[model samples]
Target: MAVELIILGVLALTAASLWIPYIVGVNTAPDGSIPADAPDGFIIPPDPNVHRPWVRRAYRAHLNLLEQSVPFAILVLLVDRVDGFSALTLWASIAFLILRIAHAVGYITGTARFPGRPLIFTGGWICCLLMAWAFFAA
Candidate 1:
């Protein structure tokens, strides 16, 4: 349970940090204003047409993290309730968190095309799989 809570805290922080690139990108426009043709009173509407590679990458990564996190949180809680924490569960939880951080960094830095991002993502999945196996095997 302690390890799960720690991972939750880390995930929350990771989600929060994803906003940095988006906020900076939004404010980068001239005078921090939307396009002249944009509807009035529209604040911070996401423009899918954003051309900046880093900003796009950050947004995609943020969404991806969110998608993965929901299931991860559910699985962690289930494991905590059903199997209780053992060495395998604790270590798997830690590994998942670490891999998530690495994946986010690789995504933001545009290095996802190489080995770092994909490998990190795969490692996270493996951790999740281990946790699931622990639940069933117990």
Candidate 2:
């Protein structure tokens, strides 16, 4: 239940989420094909026909998770700093981070279809809820 770890994990996932399109060349290639090279400086071919939709979806999902969790992370850190510690909040935040990363990886990598991604997504949301509850309860 380390708040530092939670923060670090959150930052890790956040960076990965933001970097995916550029790193993976999301919009550069034609449908289901990798581009020979990505375009320069934030401009690239648009994704055609939902090509590589999972990659796009994964990026957005991770970004959304980060957006949703940042406030909770801050609140947890603030409370932890003021109080001795917030074990519940810290654990929940860590859980959220772990689940988010797993969810993104699973979705992007084409892991088992249907239920697996949903479960991971659900796990992340539950962690977020737990973190929020701990923040308020504190």
Per-model TM-score on C-alpha atoms: 0.80, 0.62
Residues 1-138 of candidate 2: C-alpha lDDT, one tens digit per residue: 566455756566675556565346554645636444644322333354434566556555656556656765665666565563466756666777677667666656667358886777777667666655655666
In model 1, the clashing pairs are none
Best by lDDT: 1
Local accuracy of candidate 1 as per-residue lDDT tens digits, 14-53: 8778878766766685553466667533334455553366
Instruction: Return the number of clashes found in candidate 2.
Output: 0
lDDT of 2 at 130: 69
**Stretches > 4 Å off in candidate 1:** 30-34, 39-49
Residue pairs of candidate 2 with colliding backbone atoms: none
Q: Which candidate number would show the highest TM-score if scored against the true structure? A: 1
Poorly placed runs, candidate 2 (over 4 Å): 1-13, 21-23, 27-50, 81-84
